[model samples]
Target: MAGQQVYLDHNATGPMHPEVVAAVLPYIQGGFGNPSAPYAIGQENHRAVDRAREQVAGLVGATAGDVVFTGGGTEANNLAISGAFLGRSEPMRRHLVLSAIEHPSVRETCAWLEAVHGAEVTVVGVGCDGRVRLDELAAALRPDTLLVTVMHANNETGVLQPVAEIGQLLRDRGVRFHVDGVQAAGRIPVDVAAIGCQSYSLSAHKFGGLKGTGALILRDPSGVMPILQGGHQERGWRAGTENVPGIVSMGAAADVARRDLSANMAHGLALRVIFDNLSARIPQCWRNGHAGLRLPNTTSLCCYHADAMSVVLALSSVGISVGTGSACASHSQEPSHVLLAMGLDEQAAFCTIRISTGPENTVEEARWAADQIAQAVERVRLVTAPEDIGGCGEDCPCFAHSSR
Candidate 1:
């Protein structure tokens, strides 16, 4: 029972930690009550939600009062982008800026503002290494620029942006700054006061908590408005009954992450070595994203002259979990807008696989996963090759062909 399967897609969604599960079980089964109700059980549920806020805020170096809970990262992102822009006074601010390589939630939110709300948007492009240019960011700021939103880590590349540098640049500019910390929240240490961003967003599932619960951190100076209005919930920022159990689990998970991130990063670093070596053995294998300064758990490798979906399916057969591009946007065949904006061609974009390691994976499990992946890539490459299409050394049913 110790090592039956290897899960290497933590970036897509980390497995729920047992401690978090244990803490959350009672809330789901016995502690079910609406936080808004005036009864004793409901008040108890509200306290659990408040405690979760403290845990989350502690992880980000903020007070619990500043955290506003939302449905998930997407909702948090939407609330941050749309809510902040909507809160601005007319004539004082009219422009918005975001990184081109941002998650779709941010990218799409910016687009919606421009198309639907008639706001001006400027999306700065990243270089080949998937980093936003700080100089470009400084140049783009305007007197009318209402907000600047960027991610702490790229969902596709795991490459971190210069958030503190950007924050410093915007310090005196009077522009409200927002950061999407959904991917980087628990994987890396985040200090909101030090980063100096006025607001930030995060999802529980990304960091080993249950899905459908997230938080938006807002500094009082930013004065963001609520996207929806109902009761006094989330201090009128997001209105819905507080999801007490999910919040309780998120707090439990946050506490665990704060204590265990160093060890988690170490485990990831070990797995990355095996992952990199396996990709190196393949023809034209190229590792994308930050070379050294990256998330410890993520490896985005592109196999040249092969199909990514095909390779993914082959590994899935052997119970290896992975992702091609952002799991949120995988339904679309269009190249990862994040990678493409970072200077990858369509072919390179299509050939990518994202593997993220968890603390549960052992070194042997990591190596075995690498072996299976290498074999799968080779098998798929041979099948897709025109010359090898007709003949086979050891004929096997082509899973990739059937999937296509």
Candidate 2:
């Protein structure tokens, strides 16, 4: 077991960047003042928030006014979905469409709306390649469809969705579109206008900022209602006192991500290539998702006849951190819904693990991590009996539907 620790789960969350930490130090130390206060210190903090807004907007090709800071990505998603549906004047437009592979934040929010608010929800399926089926999405639309929400990039498989095409399709149909850009914002070049989404969601933690801060970029704030009602903060779009230090940290992280976008992407691509080549040597170990149309930093590997959780534990024992699926649903015993939506059987879904690199990772680390993963999978397969190594227990819902 290596003494040194390697973190390859950037999709779940990442350590704060040094620049981000530096940017927030003053606010945390003594620069604390309520942005709403009518004093000099308050005005200063207010301006800081405005500057942070502009910085985040610059990275996503949005205006400062379009950025509304929220508690996190999940809150941003809730605001986008629930706000849009609840804010509309016409109750007839109650139909909502979503991609089957969206993060739990998006999926669960939509489900809540259907259950509690009488909204009609339609989930469009994905192909074996892990990309959403555009034709199926089009077929699922209706005259009463209020919105279509899809992720810009998938968290589990790292597959890039056809957001531009979907945007155009929804535009032609006169329907609103929302993009969950949580995993895409800092990793890829994003232009909300170019993508034609009415709203977009991103979490700062995914890109090296603090976990409690995120933002929603709204093309027109008037189109959605405020989910949190109170004093006029965030231009009355979001309520409650501003998180000064966290927002400032997000701004600094955004600036660093924008400046090093090209170089960081190249570095990640190099590391992915190295890791993929090395891991391919393992028997029956195949990479999931579209090879050419996925995030450069993410790799989803499925090892046949190996329990994914066992592999995760083995890797952890060796001072390596990875994920079986979304960290949000880490406690769930079910197999990955994203993989199942992409046509993987329950057994295959249970055998998958996700490895997402970050700016701090290096080519040498990628190679070593892949070697460790291969050894871990081998050990897991050797210990578990063949019949006992398959999908979840019979009590699991997926077990009933599984062909295995």
In order, the Cα lDDT scores of the candidates are 0.84, 0.90
Which 10 residues in a row give candidate 2 its minimum summed lDDT?
A: 395-404
Off by over 4 Å in 2: 390-404
Model 2 RMSD in angstroms: 3.7
- After superposition on all C-alphas, the RMSD of every candidate to the true structure, in Å, is 4.6, 3.7
Q: Write the per-residue lDDT of candidate 2 for residues 1-404, one digit (tens) a residue.
A: 26988999999999999989999998899889999999988888999999999999999999998999999999999999999999987889999999999998999999999999999999999999989899999999999999999999999989999999999888867688999999999999999999999999989998889989999998866557999988799989889999999899889999999998999899989988876674468898888989889998988988888888889989999889999877776656677899999888778887888999999997788888888988998989988765665445646664332443
Scored by lDDT, the top model is: 2
